[model samples]
Target: MSIATLSATPPPPSSRAARRTGRLFALTGAFVGVVYGYDTGSISGALVFLSRDFHLTEVEKGLVNSILVCGSIVGALIGGKLADALGRKAAMLIVAGSYAVFVALSALAPNVVVLDLVRFLLGVAIGISIVAAPLYVAESTPARIRGASVAAYQVATVAGIVITYFVNWGLSGGGHWRWMLGLSALPAALVLIPLLRLPDTPRWYVLKGRTERAVEVMAMTDPDVDPRAEVAAVSAALAEESGGSARSLLRKPYARAAFFVVGLGFFCQITGINAVTYYSPQIFEEMGFTGDGQNFLLPSFVQLASLAATVLAILVIDRLGRRVVLLCGIGTMVMMLAVLTAVFGTGELSGATTWIGFGAILLFTAAFNFGFGSLIWVYASEAFPAQLRSTGASVMLTADLVANLLIAQFFPSLMAWAGAARTFAGLAALALAALVFASATAPETKGRQLEEIQGYWRNGGRWPVAPEPREVSPGPLSPTGPAGCAERGA
Candidate 1:
């Protein structure tokens, strides 16, 4: 059906079947987050045992940890093209399989070199999953709950981390780092099983010119949605695509969106969240919580706080809006970091001061999880049009990987050279900058449909002017006259 014809017909009412289908896809997609969390969290605890077993130097230890991020950088660089060419579901399946293989290999590594190489390969899978899972969730779900659905991935990620902490604690006594690392393979296998049954998203089908199948999938996911109307909207959007290359993102309007996505990513990582996540036990040790028992117990508390905060973000992100949560979260993080800097800088690493530092770490984790940690992927997944969503997310995630690599790789040296206080002060400064950038430019995408969000960017970051009843222009890509807005809705 033509865009004009489809737009004139009102959307069908939503049905329980459709909502169930959407929820299923969302939950399945979140398994990718579990794989990610397990891999990341498992490493932090494993590092201690791995270091003892392998006799790893400080620099070598960092490499073992940072190499995965390095591999993820390459993975993200190519993830956009892979997702676009292979389709999101196919790409994610590949990611899950790769994770299964490499994580198992990481457990068997005879030396640090083999471990680093295997971890990097696993990272590539992580990079692809990061881009594909959220893209699929954003496209399959309805706009009203899009933010919460996408944030579900983050919730699952934190959940995975929390689970790993307990696993690490259980295994820490025996120094069974191999078992800790190998356990990640279980989640990767779990993620793969569900993906085997899932379908490629409707938007993807439309992009491939399979309008009938697109409609069928949409019907299954949202019984109330008018499939034909949605297909027309998809068709119109695809027709407007200049190309899907990275170069295309450098063009007008898209360039701005790319910058915004990248900035969001940079801010998310620069705040030192990964440093804390990857090395929380080490940090606790530095703060006078030495010995095996204290190290295992204290860091778990930090992760628990993160897990709770992520749940809070998922509940309230759509209601309070992205900008508000992000700004507030980052601002709170800055205060916590400043307090940490003061505590660490004064060389008061004993008694009440150490306890205060522990509290500050928990608070920092809470704030970061509530804001940027949850919103970064949600925002990236929704910011661009369907044609560019994969690439846009990859670009944004690549920026995150870069920040993670640098921070993870250099955190120890930074702490050693500059001291923990100075290191924290530096992060606090970066958080302040993120707060400013988000305040001035963050878009409110709480309730808008994905296409409406595109229209907002197309109209230069403001809402598109109300659709006027002008004559429909020639060609499929031309404006759909007054009914154009009807497709996207109020």
Candidate 2:
């Protein structure tokens, strides 16, 4: 297949089968999100009880949270390579099984050291899942609905968070944090059964030179399309990719895309979303919501708001495009954070001021979920060529995990040292940076075919340059001046 033979348009799918396959993949892949959400959310409520049981100091408590993040960083670093080597389905299966085992182990931990080790191991699964699940969805699904399909994973994540909050609320009375952490393992086990049966993506098969298998999966995934054509197109695109290496990503077009993705990943965490999610109870307590019911209820409301906004993103992402939604969401977050900073910075918290802070935090939650939260995975999944997609997504996810680790370790102390207002204000500054970055560098990948998107960066980070102009002989309307110069009608 030649460059000229490459089609900018994605091959059309049999509507019914495509929809079926897409929905199935989206739902099953979302188990990754479920594990992530439960892991991240369960700790917030569990930490309170864990602290009491272990007589933990503040720094020790922070370690319990930060160790998972450090594990996630390690996971993200290795996950891409694992996915590429083992295939996406296998990687996800490994992640699910790990989640099941490690989460259960976490519940049984006798000391903070053991708990930290288990949680960190779980984080590695999380890091691998985040990369593999989205990569599978991106590679398997049709381009037309890719954004929403990928965003569905996030919806599952938010749903998992919401479910954990309710679990936290229900169990808070008994101080049964063990049960709270143990509950996540059940879902992890359930998701694994389906993942075990799922097929590796057609693209991955093609990458492995198994064209017959690729065609078979493609037919099942999109029955109306000519499997041969689809396979050939993917093969042609793969042929153009340089030998897959971390070094290749550092050069030219991949480097440019990497910068944008890594920046987004950093900003996503530094903007304080995770800090708020992980420490919502702490934040609420500081806001004068000391009652047990108030402590659990408020964070539920925040997660609910986040879940709703993620649904909204799913509806409009492909239509509104990635850049528009990202800028709007980040801009909204910055504004809400500004409100929070102003309310908290001035003085003591009154009832009215507390309500204002609550409102601002909820709005910020909605805005972050509506924009960057949903789109970051979508963007990372599609930005690189198929050959490097998994590795590329891993790189970006690793950046996100790195940011998460920093925020997790220091956010509490930062809040203590700087005060809530200044801490939020600092996040607002990061949000502002995110908004600017999205506006200037984020690619508009709303409806483009993956190959078409790869083509954008194939020529060393710029669109292919047009050919040089050729000289034209003087025409009837032309006026000749010096030597051989010719002027046209103009």
Candidate 3:
């Protein structure tokens, strides 16, 4: 594919009305992200206060933190199917409301048991948001700008983490962990307000056999433009298709694609991003940052770094392409992990070495955002044939949430036994494996149309049909060909 072909699909043009409405979609998605970030990061600060208030042991505190991850496993496994079946808009509204209600209840809980249950329920809501918001955005966005659009989810997530850190810092000082937990509800409530006006995915409308409705929805997403081209594209892809069934994902045509997406999901969580994103402050303190205030201040920068890296990714991804970015990022992560291992293992680690370790952490975050963080969702959505896209996404998210559960449940213990430095090293090794797999097998999709990417790996990674011509055509071959073609008549 030529660069021009990949760059041609511009974001949907908007009328003043549609432009206003688009903000509502963005705000609602951001609210969902805020809730996700809060649930994941809130425990980092509150763990100390909660331990004191409840007289909790270290193991129990870890378990409390792990409960949500466990619940996320089940929630992620089923959330996609539920969205596809019940409708993305309906599922999000229900989840947004329930997420708020249950999380607020957790804030009021008197004991660890109640708190654990609340965390578990909150995880389910988060799991739902993870799948729903991206799917909604992907279905809504035009192919040209889809990468930037869905990346808005990660931006919201990072923002949520930063805000929660500040909130926890301010509130936890006054024995206000309950308020810390309860304040999460504010964003959840706000998300629902705009969700009431948000349109359903045009793809979902196609699935439901609502052709006219689908076109109507598509038009609203880009009111200044005609929907005919977009509608016809989806319709042609879905021709002879019923609404995609879950079982279809396991069939021969889709099974490999399904596995690829699921593996992508698994690799995403296994990179130990959550271990850092959720627990970085705790990890920093353990690494011997004695001052509480400094530890808190440092992680906010990490969040900032993550957001900046993702923005960079959006700019370069279509240009550099996916495989190159994933390999380069993961390779750098391994090097950083190796440095972290040496730094922490030496009892002499202090001053300069500590600063180096800190720098390594920042580098790792930047690398992850550039690759796994950005590409996983993009690849998962585009990898499958249209008939199985939703099912493949559902399966992919299940693997991700499952890995999330394992890491959340055991990472503290792993740190306890293996130490944070070594644990990071292990994650780095896993990242290396993902890099190898990606390099050896993943196809380049930089300039290909989303619908065309399904066949990317076939024909030895060349399009069977010659890609859009990159050079101007020579005049029809003369009997003796052109002078340049004859090399100046040699």
- The prediction achieving the highest lDDT against the true structure is 1
TM-score of 3: 0.84
Clashing pairs in 1: 13-224, 14-224
lDDT of each model, Cα atoms only?
0.82, 0.81, 0.74
Clash-forming residue pairs, model 3: none
How many steric clashes does model 1 contain?
2
Error of 1 at 42 (Å): 1.0
Number of colliding residue pairs in each model: 2, 0, 0
Location of the lowest summed lDDT over 10 successive residues in candidate 1 = 2-11
lDDT tens string, model 1, 89-173?
8988898889889999999999998999899899888877777778888888876677678778878888888888888888888
Error of 3 at 428 (Å): 2.7
Q: How well does candidate 1 score on lDDT at residue 378?
A: 75
TM per model? Answer: 0.84, 0.85, 0.84
Question: Worst ten-residue run, lDDT, model 3?
Answer: 1-10
- Looking at model 2, which ten-residue stretch has the lowest summed lDDT? 481-490
